[model samples]
Structures are given as C-alpha cells and as structure tokens.
Target chain A: MLNRVLHRRTSALVCSALTAALTGCGGGVDVIGYDVTIQQTSQCTVTGAAARNCEDPAVLGQTSLAARWFLETADDGVSVTVTTHEGRTIPGLLFDNNTNVINTEGCAGEGGRCVFVRRRYQTSDVNTGCSTFGELIFVGHFPPDAPQRLVGRFSDVAGNTEECGTPTINEVVFSVNGAKVEQPAQSLEGARP
Target chain B: MNRPLPMSPVLVGLAIGFAGCAGDGIDFFEVVRSRVDECAIRSNGEFCVEPEQFDPPTVEVWAVETRAEVALLYVDEEVWVLDPLPGDADPATVERTATKTSVVIDGLTGCRTDAVREVGFLSVVTRSAFGTTGTLDGSLSVRSVLTGPESCGSTPVGERTVDVVSGTVSGP
Candidate 1:
C-alpha cells in the first residue's frame, strides 16, 4: 500500500511540471498594436496657367486646403498624441506653412517651427513609401483592461500669395490605420482541469 | 496532453536508474524526489527554455528645426515649393512637392559636425517655361539660417532662391 501511494504521488507531480512548461511555451501575451494615416486636399484658380502631362518638374498651384491625421492603438496600455511642424526659413507642408492669414494683415516672415509629444512610436508595420513623412511612438502598459485609440485634426490653409491669390476651394483625405487587433481563440486544452 | 501517467518515459527512466538499488536499502521515493529536483533546476519549471517576444523601441521628444520656401512667379505664372530637410545620420534621397512643382532633392543632407552644420539641398525647382517674351528675373526666395556663422558651405546656407523661368537653381 505504501509503494502504491508513493508511485501515484510521483506520477502526479511529473504531470504538473510538464503542464507548466507547455503553458509557458505556447506564447507570451501580446503587448501593443498600431495604425496611422495622412491625407490632404488642395484647390487653386489658374489664371493663364495650363497644365501639361504635369508628370513632374512642372509647377502647379492651389488656393485653400485642409490636412488631417489619424493614429490609434489596440491596447489601452498604449497612449498616442500628435504635434505639427512647419518651415521657418525654407517651406513646410503642415498647411499654410509659409502663409499667414489669421489677421488678413498677412505674415511677413521667412521661417517656422514644429514639434511632437510624448514617447512616440509607429504601431503598424505597413510599408508607407513616406515612412519618414510621419512618426510613431509607444511602449507597453498593464492590467490588460480595455482597447485604446486616438484621432487628431492637422491644419488648414487659404491662398496667401499676393500674386495669384489663394485658390477658391479643394478636398483632402487622410487615413488612420487600424491596430488589426487579434481576438485570441479560446482553447479547450486550457479549459481541461 | 499533460495528464498524469502511471508509467511514462520519464518515470520508466527514473525507475530503471536505481531499480535494483532498492536492495541496498535506499528509499525509492526519496531518490525520485532528489532526481526531480535536479531536473527542475535544469528546466526552470519546464522541459525547455522559452523564447522571448519582442517589439520596437519608443523614443522621447526633442527640439526639431524646419525651413520651407514657396515662389509664385509673375513672369510665367509658375509656383515652386520647398521645405526643410530632415537631419538624420543614415541619409536618404527624397522628393517633396512644393506647390505645383515636385522638388526631388538627390542630396538633402545635414549632420552635427564640429558643432556646426555640414549639409545642403539639391533639386530641380521649376520646369522650363516656354514663353518668347518672359525674362529670367522672377525667382523664388525663402531662407531661415539654422546653421552656425560658417554656413551654406562656401556657397552660404541662406535664402534658397531658384530662377523659376531660367531653370537655374539655388538652395540653403
């Protein structure tokens, strides 16, 4: 009876040890997921200007315009924020980067500024030809609570050129990619006591 | 898959290691416990080492300087747009659209060298205008010198003005 009892106990302990390992090897918990998009629309009134194949090198003009950005995450532990940038000396495209029309007096300057907030990171792995165009930022967080998300508006510009004057109107489009959140399927193996 | 087994490969091996040694009066259960401790130390509660899952690193914010230029010339009614080049060590060539003209700079470069900027931008600003009467007078000029006193190389990094009609170029 003593030997039988001892054998039973050893077998149980062996099983427990193996089970613990299988669980660990399955896969660690997911940490973060990211999605982002950018869009712009421009319209200009051409006086004598006629467009050619307009492939490139050719100059084009636009009047008023709007631009926006959308950034998001799947895990609430992850946070997101955005900041704008413009050229102070050269020229930037954060919208009206070179034009000043708030007071109608117009901006008489040649330079500008830009900034980004928090620890930034790109959450998605999507290949955008313009990777440096925008940036991403994020680390990890806890509790495994709710999902996370963020949406932001960028800028607007009205033609400020004294020569041709700003364009009449234009349409712009931007995208904020999704986190492609995965819902882990319930496995009956773990449910088995 | 991990259900307890009355006789498993591990159990058989353990039993065989010291099978007949029980005749020497060694406690079988105690020997089994000792063997298990050795195996546990080697495997860390499992039968193998698990690989770690990893993701990309995050970055903190810092001051970023930017510059841009736009020229709406009256001569041929052409527009030129240009913006500041990103300052990174591992450089890359990029094409940025100004207004109507797409400015692709083959070498828009900059770096922190000897406490100064060793960088420049090159691009075909405006397309050649075809007008018999227009003069090469109207040009695009935008400048915000973010470099030290000795800037723009020997050429000077100031107003990046391009002769929009002449198809000639200048930069910061």
Candidate 2:
C-alpha cells in the first residue's frame, strides 16, 4: 500500500536527520593539529637588565627582551594539542609569511615597521583554559633578489638606561617556497650589533 | 476463533519503558545544549559591548605601554587564561601566565582603567623592545581590568556571549 511505502521512507528520513544533527554538533570530523617548542639560548644581547613586571610601578618603564620564535604552518599539518611543561595549554596562531611591516615612529628612525597578517583559527578545548596567542605567521613568496636580512635597532622607549639588541630566528626551513631549503644558524631574535 | 486481549502487565511495562527513555534521558541532552547556548550568548555580549567584565569573559587582548625612566623602556602584559567564570569554578582561580618567561609584568597594576573595546581574542602588541628598530616582534596577554583606557561603570551589562580567538603580530 502507498501508506506502507510512505512509512518506510519517513522512517529512513528520520534516521538521516538524527545522524546529520549529531555530526553538525562537533562530531565525525577529521581536524588537523600541531605543536611548537621554544628554547632560549645565550645569543641574547642585553646584559645586566632590570626585570619588567606589570604589577610593579618602579620597573614599569623598560624594554623586556623580545622572546625569539620559530614557527611552522601546514594545511594538512597533523593535529596535536599543545601544552606547556607546567601542565598549562598554549594558544598559537597559524604561521603566515605574507605580512607587512610598517614604522610607528616617524621616518627619522630606522626601526618602525609593523607586520600585519590575517589570522587562521584552528580549535581549542572551551572547557579548558586552552586559547590562542596571536603571533605573526610568515607564508609568502619573496622576490628572487630580495635581501635575506631586514635591518633594525632596539632602544629603551622607557626612561631606563639599557642597551638592547636585535631580534632573530635561526635554522629556518622555507616549507612553502617550492624547494625545500634549510638555513643553518638563522638568527632572527637578537638586536643587530 | 479470535485472539484474546494482550496481557495487562505486558502492556503496562512496555509503556513505562518507553516513557522512561523518552522523558528522562532526553533531558541530559537538553542540559548540555542549554549550556552551550548560554556560552554562545555570553560570546555575543563580549563582542558587542565595550570593556566587558573581566569576569564571565569571552575574548580580550591588551596593549601595555610601560613607560619607565627614559633609558629603560619595557612592556609586559597578561590576559585571562580561561573563558569567563562559568557556574562550577571560582573566578579567582583563573590565572594568566605570560607567553614567555624572563620578562616581568606578571600581575595586574593599580592604575587599571575600565575603558575597553570588544576585541574578542586578539593580542595587541602591548610593548616593543628597543632592538626592534628594523623589525621587532613581541607578544603578551592582557588583563581586562588593568590595561584598558576607560573604566566600566556600575551595573555593567550582563549575560553576554564571548568568543575565543588565536592571533599573531609581526614586522616592525
């Protein structure tokens, strides 16, 4: 009977709708993940520097050392959650190379460039404290004749009297540059001397 | 011959089983969905309102200008580690740690203002070290109450939605 046939089809539709709802609620999807580890080395330039704490007023005006970083970005990158040694989760941004660096101070100074890039949002556990730390990810094609190193200086914008150095990153692997290239001892952290 | 009526006990037991599964178990799902819905609502308030409460947080970032003596300038920042206070945990337990060690500025300062914008989860360059003349890179977490340019008034907005975002800063 037509009623019997219609009943069978209706049952099938109900089952299909339930499956779709569950899947839409963060189920049955393959998501990619990754992790990053940062290590500090002795290559830092500043010496005898006062520690800067936000909670303290006396040391309020000072330039803390720029934390050096090296990052990797991938679309098919494996999905692995990241946590600190202290059992805390770390939030990170996708590495993008195509960014613009602009100078904030007048052109009279040499080191006033700000790099801008779009964000690539991944995932995190909402219940946990896991979140993202927005840092620029580099991904783009450099001109064949583009210079390898960009020049700049670091100064104490605060009244504190201290000599700081440049920021550099070493051991860079251009993963997206068509050819897999590796540069040993790439320094992107320290101030240029 | 005609079939007799189904047994009374059999029919009653079947009805009870159907009612139990349909009524009680379904509520568990409803509870979870409601929790998520509440979070989504909170995220909306965080995005739409300015200088959202440091409590019941959704997403926020900070830019700290640590103006020290002329010779030694520095910047340090802190941000909420967890989303705004949900029902189960104590709000005071949400502690924030800097992205890196060695630098100072771990805690909130006394000169905090309430003026804030709905930045969601974005990190603004709170401070740039001196060597960044050519290109400087930095990162920090912000406290909602400390770093803002304005102050939140009494009877602040309630029941807002919040979002978690990952961001980056590069170039000069």
Candidate 3:
C-alpha cells in the first residue's frame, strides 16, 4: 500500500505516502496518482525550534525535496501553493493559510529562483487535525539549485558589516511517479486533475 | 649604549636558569605562549604556542548537510591579545590570551569538553617572573539561522543562538 521506499528526511515522505494513501488507491501509486519509485539520493532533518533539528527528511522543500506532495501548480508556474482542507490550525485562524512570507527579494542571487517564499502555506488536503504535522504547511521560493544549508552568512545575523550569501547547491531534481516532472503534472491520480 | 658586563659562574648559572624556564617546571602552554610571542615579533597571523607538554583536551565536532554538499562545524580555540599602547616606553610589550569556544562552521574538529579554552593573558616578560594566567570556566556561544529548502518551503530553520557552559570556559 504505502511504498515507504522514498528518500531522506522521513517525515515529509511518510506524510506524502500517508496523504496519498488516504484516498484509498493502494499499491505503489501516490494520492495525486503517480507511480512510485523511491530514490536514495537525499538528505534531510527535523527542525525543532532552531538550527533545524536532525532526522525529519521532509522538513524543507529545497533540501529534502518533499514538496512534491502538496505542491499545487496550476498547469503553469504562474502560481504555487500547498493547501489542506480545514485551512486553519486554530478556530477562526487560517490553517490553509499562505499568510507568512519567510524571505524577501534582496540582492541578485537571493532572487535567483522560486521567488516569494512562504511558510505554513496551506494549499491542498484541507483535512484538519490529522497528526503533529497536520497543522504545519511548508513552501519554498526555490532557485534551480534548491537543496542547501545556511543560505545567508550566519555572521550577518550578528548585525556586523557582513552580508550572507546563498550557499552552493548540492542537488535538486524533481520527478513525478517514476517519470520526470512535466508541466500540467500528468492529471492527479489518473482521474482527479 | 650599555656595555656588556663581565660574567661570573653565578651569572652564568642564572642565565642557564632563565633560558631553561621554557623547558619544564611550567605550564606547557607557557612554552607555546612564548613561541607565540616570538613569532608575533615577525608575523601578524595568530601563532599558538602549543607546548610540547600540553595535554590537548579532546573536542566535540559536528556537521550539517546542504542540498548539494555537507558543511562540518566543530569546537576550537580562539585567541586574543592586548597590544601595548602607542608611544609607550616599550612598543613591543603586549599580552596574549586564549579561550576555548564553539561556533557554527562548514566543518570543524580537534576539541573536547575536558579541554580548557586556556585564556592566556601574558604581561610584559619580567626577568624576575613569567606571565600571569587566567581562565573562564568552559563556555560556548554559537548560533546561526540556516536558510534553505530543508525546513519549510524555502524558509529559514534553526535560526537561533546556543549557549553552552562548562568548567573553565564560563561561556559568552
């Protein structure tokens, strides 16, 4: 049913499998209806409060590349979001909320790609209160070289005359159900696009 | 110019004693500290006088992975020096010190909890005595807000300072 053979940072992949399986389409395909082939090329960690804790493979969309689950691309790169049903974590609060912007376009490199990053952004799967991660939504304004650590200089936070630079990208590759990612993302689950 | 004074057995013995001060009967780091003083006379880069006798304490090290690569960070020693004021009688006069501390890095190694960030504050070398020594109970202050695709949709994660305290290095 749940092909747990996916890649690094356990949380995101497990969630992806869970999210996909909830629809009842068992046997190796994801909820959005894509064939599954787990690739071992990945690195990820769970961030608790600070310093991105270790072991949650699906924590960051860039590094872990677990964004394939909630990623909602409307036939074009014109808009991007990850949402769930309930849409609000608290009563009268926005759960499927694309409310917080984590970063802004500053100099050149930062604006490289994936413009306008946001966190706790809810776009699909509005089912409320599923588990610990149910309320948390993640998004990344990614550049081609998405996977990374320490984007800006750590010293910059010290407010010194130092400016942080994006670290070198190690790897970034997207795939859809055993096939490479293509525009219009091959009709979710072969039926519900 | 002061002319050389005639030397006797007692003077020779004393000279031998002074030169031998760096040999033993003192902190091995003192030997290293002296080497630093001697090297600074010719260069500006940091020169640690790791004495031959110095029992280097072990250090804890760690690493982090970025998308395409892995960055390693570790605990190490930081050194500081107090320079002599300008126009002083002796311009070369100065004091040196060391502190064992930790900070975020691409990668790091060669430090341990048992080791001290031995802060050495060396005053002008007096003929009658060696320099003084001081230490802060072991402590460490390091932090970073790593922004990447690891946390949430290209957001910053673990962006905070960590304060660690140990014996001898009180931490800052």
Candidate 4:
C-alpha cells in the first residue's frame, strides 16, 4: 500500500511539472480550435466616410470554429494560412525571416517573429473593395520548432479606400492553436479558366 | 571682282540627295537603339542611375508558375523585385506575385509595401515576360519603412510614401 501511494504521488508530480512547463513557455498545447473576435469600431457609411467612435454589440462577438492552419517555411521567409471549415480562408500572412521585421514593425523586439497581414474584400463590381494590411504580432514564440502551432494577436486600424462603398474597415483579434496537416489539394471545380 | 557662276543642276541635285541620306541615317539609329538605351534616356529616377553605377547590373524576368511574371532588378548589392497585379485570379496562389513590391538595400535593409494602385496615377507601364528579354516600366510609391535593427538607423528613414518614379528594368 505504501509503494502504491508513492507511485501515484510521483506520477502526479510529473504531470504537474509538464503542465507548468508548457503553460510557462506559452506553447505545446494543441487546442481544438481558434477563438476569434472582430469589432468594427468605426461606423461604416457611404455618405460621410469618417472615423467616428461607434460600437455595435451585434458586430462584436466571439466564435469558436474548426480551422486548418498551414505553415510554409522557406530559406527566405515563412508564411501561414488559416482556413476555416466554413471556407473562409486567410492566406499568405508572411513573416520574412531574412529580415528581422515585418511591415516596419520589429519582430525581434516582440520575441523574434511577426507576420504581415493584408486582406482584401471586394464587391462584384471589381472596383469596389477595401484592403486591410498591418502587422500581426506573435503572442508567444512563433514558427515553433515543430511547425505545429501558432498564436498571435492583432489590434490596429485597417486603412481602406473610398470606393469600398463604406469603409468595411474593422479590428480583428485572433488566437490560433494549429496542428500539423498535409497541404490541401486545389479543387478544379468552379475554378477560373 | 568675281561674277556669280551659274550652279549646275546636277550639283544642286547631288547636294539634296546627300542631305536626304543623312536624315535617313539618323532615323535608323534612333529606331535601332536598344531598350536599355531608351530607358537611360527617358528615366531620371534613382533606380535608373544606381543600377548603371553599380557593378553587374542585371534585369531578370521569369514566370511564377502559371500565375504571373516577375522581374528582378539587381545591382552590385541592392535588389528590387517587381510584383505584378493579379487580375481576376486567385490571390492566394499569386500572393508573392501580387501587388507587394519590395526592395532590399545593401542586401540588409529592406522594405515591402503595397503599391498605391489608383485608377490612373500608379500602374505598371510594362511587365516583363517569362523566358524572353523584356522591359519593366512604372512608378511606385512605397512606404519608406525599414525592417530589422540594422535598418533602424538608416538615413532618410521615416514613415512616409517615397515615390520611385520613371523606373525602367531592362537587360544589362
């Protein structure tokens, strides 16, 4: 009975130590999915497109969804892609390792990794659209040695053009806990010829 | 003391013929000048002169799979890559070939910014083709921002739009 109690205590101590190490390093935990929150701080209007402090609770919410996070590393740079099950994809958030900074922001100062985020949304008119491009700072150590996980946050004003009807400008914050997966095959159906 | 001599019609005709030949020769030289020469003559931007001043200035054109074509302009140490605009295509496949034009100075300090593609103001004048020698012409207004600690102290550095105008990329 004493031997059994000692064995149980050792196992519990080891588990606790492992948990502390993982949490302290800000990594090594494979989360099920990402929790994303997007808030539009500016009231979007076509008439007078000016930045005014407006908050809509309907636009501010959180969702947990299944996503596929892919990381491609080259000698020159590293790029990440997050594709959700709903077919909403954020592609090519590139972090050029060759240069120590991305989008004029120092990655080394922020713990040696950064990704430049540039996303565009357009209307069917082709001429009507808005672009959001800025720096996405890594929360913990990025480009993990195993290439399995990524955690980052972004909170900045996205600039947009006037032709986008109203500024579809928004502030996005996301935390991704990605797992390693094979490169998805490109589908030819509905592809532009 | 000398009376005006009557000019021979044949001599006058020969003079006119020689002038016409000289004019034709000038036109031929103008038409046959290489694209590099044309770029030198027409461009007044820093990109035009720096490439020539540096050693091993070369302009290379290659395709990015089936998405778009790319042009690389390399001087002694500085390099600039031209990123063309993707038209009605999947942006994911052509992200590198898309509108983010980048430049690396001294092979150390670098900056990448999206080209301000207004309707008529900023556009690629000529896009280089794959496997064939071509010329690249356009004006790009890139945000003057540098990356890395090596670039933090670089001169003329600020967060402003720097206009690189009348740039031409052609073979050495």
Candidate 5:
C-alpha cells in the first residue's frame, strides 16, 4: 500500500512539473483566454514650446478608451498591433531579440528593449512642399517569450519652423498596457470533439 | 555740333542730379535682387530637389579673416553649413581645394550627416566695400552617409550625395 502511494505521489509530481513547464513558471502566465485591459494612467507627461497638456481631450480623444491587441510571432520577431474601439490603430510594430540602439528617446533605462516608428501629419501650406506636422512616435517593448503583454509609451511632437507657421508643438505621452485576448480561431476550429 | 551747345548752370545741375539718381537706383535694385535664385541642387537619392520644397532657399556667406562660411537653408528646416574655405578662394581657384562640413536634415524624419566630403569649388564672387554684402558662384559635390533613428524604417539612412552645381550666397 505504501509503494502504491509513493507511485501515485510521483505521478502527481510529474504532472505538476509538466503543467508548470507548459504554462511557464514565475511571472509567465498563460494569456490565451484573457482579455486585454488598457487604461490611460496618470503617468503621462508633455513638453515643448507648443506642447499640449496631457489633460487636453484633443490630445488623445478620451482619457479612457477601449482597445484590443493582437500579436503575430515569426522567426524574425513579434509584430504587435493595438486597435482602439474608435478605429485608431497603431500597427506593424516589430520587436526582436537584438536590442535596438537607435532612437531610444523615451524608451530608455528599464524600457530599453523597444521598437518605435515616427509618423508625420499635416503638411504646411505656407512652407509649400515642407511638412509641418506633429510627429507621432509609438514605442513598445515585448519580450520574445512573453508576447502576451506589451508595455510601452506613445509620444507626439510637433515640428517647429517659422515658415511652417506657429505650430502647436505637442509632446504628449501615453502609456499602453495590454495582453492577448483569445487564442486563434483556427486552433479552436481544428479541435476534435 | 552747333558751335558747342552752351549749358545753363541750372540745366547742367539738373542733368547731373538725374544721372546721380539713376546710378543710385541701379545700385538699390542690385542689392534687392533675390540671392536664393542663384542656388541649385541635384541629388542622386531623394530629398532637396522639388521646387516647392526649397523654392527660395536662404543662402548666406560669412567672411571670417582667411576663411569663409556658407549656409544654405532648405525645406523641412534643414541647413547645410559649409565652412573653413580660404577667403581668397574665387571661382577659378576653388576647384583645387576641398572642405569638410556637416549637414542636418530635419524633415518628417530627422537625419544627420557628418564628415561630409565636399569636392568641387565654392567661391565668394563679390563683396561690398564694407564686406557686409557679397555673392557666391561655384559648385560642390557633397557625399556622405546619413544615420538616423532606426524606427524611421529605411527612409532616413544610407548614402546620399548632393551636388550644388551653381549657387549664389548673400552674406551678413
């Protein structure tokens, strides 16, 4: 009876080990069925000559916005996309194992592993072909193994020039936090009864 | 001529005055002429070619002792400052020497090119008596590699060469 009990205990330990290995140990939690939650926290700031205030609704539309995130993993890197309910989408942001040394800007210090892209908006009429727009910088950090959650910041900086008129040099920053919402639909479709 | 036309003092004075005024008008017009028109840019890659982009670029040349500094202000708030040229470097003798300069291109994407290899010629063609006003006429082949934010994708990085074939600069 004692030997049978020992065997049962060993089997239980082995199952537990396998579960831990599959689900990941420590902070690595399975996010297959969890919905992503993104809240515009108060840790945001803005600076520059024409920088808009963080509290300004025109900056980010609404203080609280509903959004969904998706992730695609490949051999090269992981591509992350965050889409807001209002249809604003920040897409095609890729992060790989090699730390990007260029354009660290706000993504420095602990948030070193990052990928960012700057998009310009509003072409200046007075400056003719010159563009006088706010630079929208989207920076995010997603570790290779933990593609479930993303932590990063967004910055909007206005280009300043006399010929481009007095532009509002807005440098508002926003924090983004999200997790995987659900497993791929194909996976469920392929499941056998 | 009919026994040498006799000139009245008043008529002669008025004629002299009109001649002086005409000369002054010519000088004023010369000074007011647009200095930007004398500059032209040719690029193998992208940027700095469109007329609407840098149509009337600001050109300045400053004479400092034995050297001269030239600055060209282009679109997107970009500036190309060429410096340390021999003061006596005229159009004829400028081609024999080369000057190293740096350029900062701040467009939709910010880029910087350092250690720019400037070949060809750049000469200060004319200068006013006070040395405050002048013009430049010459050409320069600028070659360098721009390094910028990686997040800018592949748009703002790589090798670029801009040839300022013929340009005139106004100095302070």
Candidate 6:
C-alpha cells in the first residue's frame, strides 16, 4: 500500500512538470527560438519575354530547389531587420499577422546562375493593432561573379529614410552558393509539344 | 443500518491552494511580442525607423524546405515609400498614410481585397515626439497554383512583392 502511494505521488509531480514545460512557462518557450521557415528555388528559360543565348534548350519548365529561411526580430522603437543563415542581410516587409514578407534579387554566376540580395524593415504597432511589412521579388539574370553583397538602410512607412535606433538590432548578412535544382515534371510534358 | 462517511476539509483546502498557485504565469501577449522583437533583431541585425532606408533581412538562419511551397498569386507583398508634401499633415493622415508607403518589389499581381475576398493586411503605427503619428501598410497574397509564363515554370517557388502603402496613423 505504501509503495503504491509513493508511486502515485511521483507520477503527479512528473505530470505537473510536463504541463509547465509544454505551456512554455517553465523556460520552455525561451529555450526554443520563434520563427517560420521559407524555402524557394526557381527555373527560367530564354523564351517569350527575352531570348538570350540558350545554353539549355528552351524547355518550358521550373527549376526547383530547396531552400530554408528563419527569422527573428528586435524592437528599436522604429523598424525591424530580418537575417538569414548564410550571414546575408534580409530585407523585406512584415504583415500585420506577424508574417515575414520578402523580396530577392540574384546575379548569374558561372553556367548562367544569377544571385541578387535585398532586405526590408517591417514593423507593427502592437498596442493599436497596426502592422506593416516590406515586400519585393527580383527575377532576372546576373553576370557570373556579380557582386554578392547587399548594403542599405531602413525607411519609414512614408518612405522617410532612417537608421537603426538600437545598434544591436541593426544590419543583416546571408550567403548563397550554387546548387543543383530539378525541373518540374509538368513543364517537361508541356515543353514536349 | 448505514455507516457515516468521513469528510476532509484539509483536502479541499489543498485543492484550492493548488489552483491558486497554478494561476501565476507570464502573459502570452508579452511573450509573443518579445519573441517577435527577438526575430527582428536576429534577422536584421539593426532595426530602422524609416521604410526608405529599409533593406532586405537575411535568409541565412532558415533551413531550406521545399514541401511548404505556396502557389503563385496575382498579388504579393511589396514595399513602397511615400513622403507627404512637407507639412501635408492633417487629421485624416492616418488612413492616407498607406498611400505614401513605397514598394520594395516592383511587380506584383493581385486584386485588392473586397467583401468577396479576405486578404489580410499587416500594418504598423508610429507616433513622433511632436504628436504626429502615421500608419504603414504592407499587403501580402498567396501564389496561384496555375501554370503560366510567370509561374516560375509551373511550380511557384519564391514569394513576390506586389504593393505597399504609407499614411498618417489613426485611431483613438
């Protein structure tokens, strides 16, 4: 009988501990980071819009690649900057729902690979439920070995340029390397015609 | 004959005490707010007050995944900058401020949200030291799942920018 009672007491304590951990009250949430992952890869061909030197057949298809993006922010009484894994500065907007809005540019490298980079400062007024984010997308070719760096400043919603209010929350960095991207199958079927 | 059952006030008191103790916890809103700030600082290194000076945040921190790919949409998030004609301040500047905001991305495809559509808007409000406040609006839309010339070759891979608006802040 005594053993059973002790076992019950231990079980209760364990359950309580687990509850606190899951609720993020017992330092659970702090131990983990907050952000979502976004991956993107694209394919382009020399057709329809502008016909350049065709390296690969103008096969209408998508160049599929797997990418990953994580985001975190700090308040500087003004705007927030997002950073990526490769130490590249991320510029984009943030929507009211706390979503990360983004825009990207790339310059082509050897073998017709282009890479471009940019960033935006997204901010929202929590107390008043007002929110804002930056957004953009760049689709084009860049010469191999084009400068692979992005440096710029943050602007207010009204297009007024400003600097980082807090030094710690300023600046961002990222990196991009050549990777093999697969073409979508549907495009292959469509291009056959 | 029936036997009387025993009642324990001590047990009832313990239960009440435990319930009270469990109520102590950090606020969810506060924690999420802090986390948002942390994410901004981590990605941007430094936060800016002005949208014109804003640059793209970093993508290095994320681990690439292809499964969550969203279809290309007609409209996408864009950034724009709009500065009011010096001293164009007015009480209605709040709603009109979004007009002044700029687009970070040049081309985006989407229709405005209406009663038929429930597209969301992310906005931010700022109050200057001189009691002037403004609101910045950023619009986001999902990618469409149709094959087209601009569909990134059938499978939409990346997010695009559509439009941005800026105006003076409003609200009580």
Best by lDDT: 5
In model 6, the Cα lDDT at residue B5 comes to: 21
In CAPRI terms, model 5 is classed as incorrect
* TM-score-sorted candidate list, best first: 5, 4, 6, 2, 3, 1
The digit string of per-residue lDDT tens for model 5 on A1-193 reads: 9965555555555444454344333122111221333333333333335344555344333333223333322234444443332223344555443445444543444432455555566765653544566666566665455765666666556664455445335455567665654442112222211
TM-score of each: 0.16, 0.18, 0.17, 0.27, 0.30, 0.18
Candidate ordering by lDDT (highest first): 5, 4, 6, 2, 3, 1
Give me candidate 3's TM-score against the actual structure: 0.17
Off by over 4 Å in 5: A1-62, A71-93, A97-114, A126-131, A143-146, A158-165, A183-193, B1-172
Q: Report the poorest 10 consecutive residues by lDDT, candidate 6 chain B.
A: B27-36
* CA-lDDT, candidates in order: 0.24, 0.25, 0.25, 0.32, 0.39, 0.26
For residues A6-93, what per-residue lDDT tens digits would candidate 1 score against the true structure?
Answer: 6677665555445434433211222122232323222233323333222122211111112112222112322333321121111111
The most accurate candidate by TM-score is 5
Between 2 and 5, whose DockQ is larger?
Answer: 2
Better of 4 and 6 by TM-score: 4
Evaluated on CA atoms against the true complex, candidate 4 attains a DockQ of 0.01
Residues B1-172 of candidate 4 have per-residue lDDT tens digits of 3333233433443443343332111000001111221112111222233334433323333221211122222222222232333465432333221122222232223332111111011212223365232222323232333333444454333332222222233332
Candidate 2 structure quality by residue, lDDT tens digits, B46-105? 433443333442322222111110001112122111122234443124321222211212
Here, model 1's chain A TM-score works out at 0.20
Instruction: At residue B43, give the lDDT of candidate 3.
Output: 20
Model 1 TM:
0.16
Q: Positional deviation of B43 in candidate 1, in angstroms?
A: 61
Single out the weakest 10-residue window by summed lDDT for candidate 2 chain B: B26-35
Candidate 6 TM-score over all chains jointly:
0.18
- The two-chain DockQ for each candidate, comma-separated, is 0.02, 0.03, 0.01, 0.01, 0.01, 0.02
| Greater-TM-score candidate between 3 and 4 | 4
Best by DockQ: 2
Stronger candidate by lDDT (5 vs 6): 5
The Cα error of candidate 3 at residue A111, in Å, is: 48
